[model samples]
Target: MTADSLPPWLRQPLAELLRQRGHAWLLQGPSGLGQYELGLALAAAWLCEQPEEAKAQGACGHCPSCHAIQVRTHADLCVLMPEVAMQALGWPLDEKSQADIDDKKRKPSREIRVEAMRDAIGFAQRTSARGRGKAVLIYPAERMNNITANALLKTLEEPVGEVRFVLASEAAWQLLPTIRSRCLGFTLPWPDSGQAQDWLVGQGVPAADAPGLLRAAGGRPSDALRLASQGQSPKAWSLLPKAMSRGEVGALSEHAPAQAIGALQKLCHDLMAVDCGALPRFFEPADLPPAPPRAALARWSRSLASAAKTAEHPFNAGLMLEALVSEARTTLNSASRRP
Candidate 1:
């Protein structure tokens, strides 16, 4: 995105990070804190031909290097994301990998494959194709399985030419300490509330609705924008508590099984908070129904967690969702037996 369109909060950090020097970096923070965006910008700036200009104001958005990146055609950039993520980001897979996926030879791997890691290691060793140095941007680095991570560890430990690494993660603790020790670490900064709200408004979220969405996202602006983009609105979200309490499945029916379960999990979370006399974080307190019995909430929490483990590979999505919502209904409608 152009500097004009970049979120206000990310501007300074992006600029500051670009000015620093490092062959490898670990950008870690909780989900929705812009780790991926920051990592991409840092990589682009590194590969940008206009170093002086990019250093001052992030990537020069219109340069050939920047344009190549925007199109996912940058010769010197290797983005090592999960196959699913690579597909989502419009990054093309290697020809053989693409053919395999196209022919349904195997399912798209959710974990970065060892094969991809080996290719990246080779890429890192090659001379920079664009005269600028090479960069490997791995987002949600936690997704690397142990075997794949081990393959990348050697390259991370020792420098090979001008190749650079930017590993961005929401769950940094999942990484091997040895892998982490090889890179400089930068924790992402949380944006100020006012700044986030303003940026949300600028991104087409209604000004009045921004605060509620922002709160629903637990102050994560990227998540708030995603919620809005996915047809969620503040009003609809506020109605979720009461909807779940009444066993109304419609509030969550439109979402995929995983997403629906996630919303229910949040509702369960808030109900637990209300039971403990604490204000809710993801929903407006006044909009919530009376809290469920602690026993029921706990039971449902365990069940939801179990379901989350297999939510991605459900045998029958409709049945799975029905079962999940039914379980939620039982817990939400239960009452405390305590005097």
Candidate 2:
């Protein structure tokens, strides 16, 4: 959706805050839930001298600043993303693929490195590129490691005249408490199930597949739509039931690539959400091909939690997926055996 069509709850308050003329905001939400979009819109509004409504929301879509923000080429707006030095080499990147191609063409580090944070700080401190206030959007803000966070502390503490920092993160709690407290928190709401499902169907997903996508996404429409776009192979889903039900961790490795791990995580998450009385209507049965049973659900809940814990400690992608799959299969098997 265009920035203007952003939900009223977020747009109105943000519009009011920007109108006040000197405020920085932290928008926290699930990834792909419109935090970045709001940030860019706000940046455009800040730079736009003549907004369409003649109010705080001044970045009219027709204006040059709005267009630049939409295209992510604004002169004064600095976007700090994970650096990709090796994109030139054009290595066929895949999951578990983490080797730097070469010194000159090294792929970007998985984690946001300290150097990225430093560059962002440098840009923010420089004179505004367009004589307007400098705007910074640090995506996945928690990606900044401890050293980078420390480096950022100096800038966050002081008021850089005419400069605004917008930090967007899926997991804001991972950030240092001091940094989090410094900025205004804007918690974004996920779209309703209807909106999410409609968005998915509009994107060429068959109506039958919409249910699985919706359930998998937990009513988060954008996420469901994105996963649908990737066209995850059916083998991954086919193996999922058996893995979780029988503790057959190997079942997962047979069919799933590391890329599918994230989707698997969401699937288990959906199972947990559903078991807890929250029906995530976004996932369509056809898209994800759901297999639901009470016993299976309980097993999935127990196994997925344990697997998540293990995955966090060593970051073993294979082990994690296997554990998740095994737990889910065991759960389903138990359900079938139940009298």
Candidate 3:
């Protein structure tokens, strides 16, 4: 998407980033803040064929380079992402990798593989294909394992030819210090509540649902939009805390293990917040059941944290949801039974 279509909160940062001079940049922040969008915009601007004056506004939407990126076939741009993410975002995989997965010889990887990093390094050393310099855009850069990160280190530190690099990450702390040391770092800005709600409504979220979805996302506009796109109504989210308190498995039955765990964590967080004399962040105070005892909430919080680590590969998703809801019910009921 063109920078013009980016969320209002990102426009200023996009223009600011376009004006800066850096061969390698690291766009970092928590999830749902638009690190990937900003990184892509910066890369597009660098490779755009527009006149310098026009380029200053971000990539001119009509240029061949911009078109190529829009179609995920830009010869001068190399995107380094996990195979799963690449497919999800419409980027074509190299023939060999695609063939292997299609042939059922291997599964799409969740982490950036070392082999892909080597190919990207080779791309960096090659001559620019479209006259303009080439760029390597790596999203969720923390997905690179130690070996893969090392493969990129030398190229990142001392680039070949006119190539530039942009690594976007939701968790920058997980990156190697050397990798962090080599690139200019930019933290994505958090949009104000009003801006976030407005953007959500603009993205087709019903205006009435915007505030609740925004709250559910903890004020991350992109995340709120994602929840809307997933068919999660504001009313459904508001009812979740009470549903979990009632030990209702169907409330989270459709969610993946990881998602259910995340929803539960938010509930635990809000309950703890109310217990500590603060407002709930994810749910309205009236929507939430009475605060659980601090000790019981603390135990549940730890349990959810432990569950999250294994949520991605649960042995049985059904059993996991049942257990999680059961724990939530017990913890949520503890305060009411207090003498």
Candidate 4:
């Protein structure tokens, strides 16, 4: 996509980043804040063929370089992501890797492979295929395991030729300190609620569902859009807290174990907030049951956190969800007996 096509909240940041001079940049923040989008936009601006004046606004959408990126065929741009992310984002994998997976030799990797990093290092040393420079974009940079990160260290520290790098991550704290030390760090900004809501409507979310979805995502617009795309209705989200209190497993039955646990965690968080005489962040006060005792809520919160560690590989999703709901019911019922 063109740089101008990025979300409104990211445009100003794009311009700001373009004006800076850095061989390597680290764009970091929580998920759903467009770290990947901004990184790609910056890459495009660096490689854009447009005049300097037009480049300041971001990439010229009509340029050949921009089109190459749009179609994922830019010879000078190397994107490092998990195989799953590369496939989902429509970036073509190297022929060897694609053929291996096609032949069922092995499953696609979830982490950045060292082999890919080695290839990228070689690419960085090559002359620019186009008149402009080269770029390497790495998303979820934390996905790089130690071996892969180490492979990239030398190249990042003392780059050769006219190449630039942008590493975007949702969990920058997980990255190697050396990797973080080599790049200019930029944190993505959080858009205000009104701007987020308007953008959601622009993305075709029903205006009526915007507020509830926004709350469901903890005010992350990209997450809100994702929730809408997943068929999570605003009404169902609003009912989730009370449904858990009543021990209704079916309310969360459709979700994977990890997602179900996350929803429960948000519910637990809101209950704790209300117990402490503060407004809830994920659910409306009226939608929540009466506040449970702080001790009970705290216990439930700890359990949820522990469960989250293994939520991705539950022994039995059915049993796990039932137990989670049962505990929620017990904690929520404590509110009635608090007197």
Best by TM-score: 3
Q: How do these models rank on lDDT, best leading?
A: 4, 3, 1, 2
For residues 1-339, what per-residue lDDT tens digits would candidate 1 score against the true structure? 445446777778777777788889999998888888888988888888885764576777888998999999999999998889999878899999999999999978888898999999999999998898899999889999899998998899886999999999999999988889988999988999998899889889999999989988888999999989888878888888777666677778888888888888888898898899888878888887777778888989999999999989899988887788777767766754433
Candidate 4's displacement at residue 330, Å, is 2.7
Better of 1 and 4 by TM-score: 4
lDDT of 2: 0.62
Error of 4 at 107 (Å): 3.0
- lDDT value, residue 130 of candidate 4: 90
- Winner on TM-score between 2 and 4 is 4
For model 2, residues 48-144, the per-residue Cα lDDT tens digits are: 6464467455466666666676665677877654444223222222233344444335655645667767777887778876776788777668877
Q: Pick the candidate with the highest lDDT.
A: 4
TM-scores across all candidates?
0.93, 0.71, 0.96, 0.94
RMSD for each model, in Å, please? 1.9, 6.2, 1.4, 1.8
Q: List, residue by residue over 1-339, the lDDT tens digit for candidate 3.
A: 568978888889989888888899999998999988888988899999988877776888788999999998899999989999999889999999999999999999999999999999999999999999999999899999999999999999999999999999999999999999999999999999988888887878899999999899888888888888888778889999889888999999888999899889989999888888999988988999988778898999999999999998999999999999999999998988755
True lDDT of residue 1, candidate 1: 42
| lDDT score of residue 331 within candidate 1 | 72
lDDT of the candidates, in the order given: 0.85, 0.62, 0.91, 0.92
Pairs with steric clashes in candidate 1: none
Descending-TM-score candidate ranking: 3, 4, 1, 2
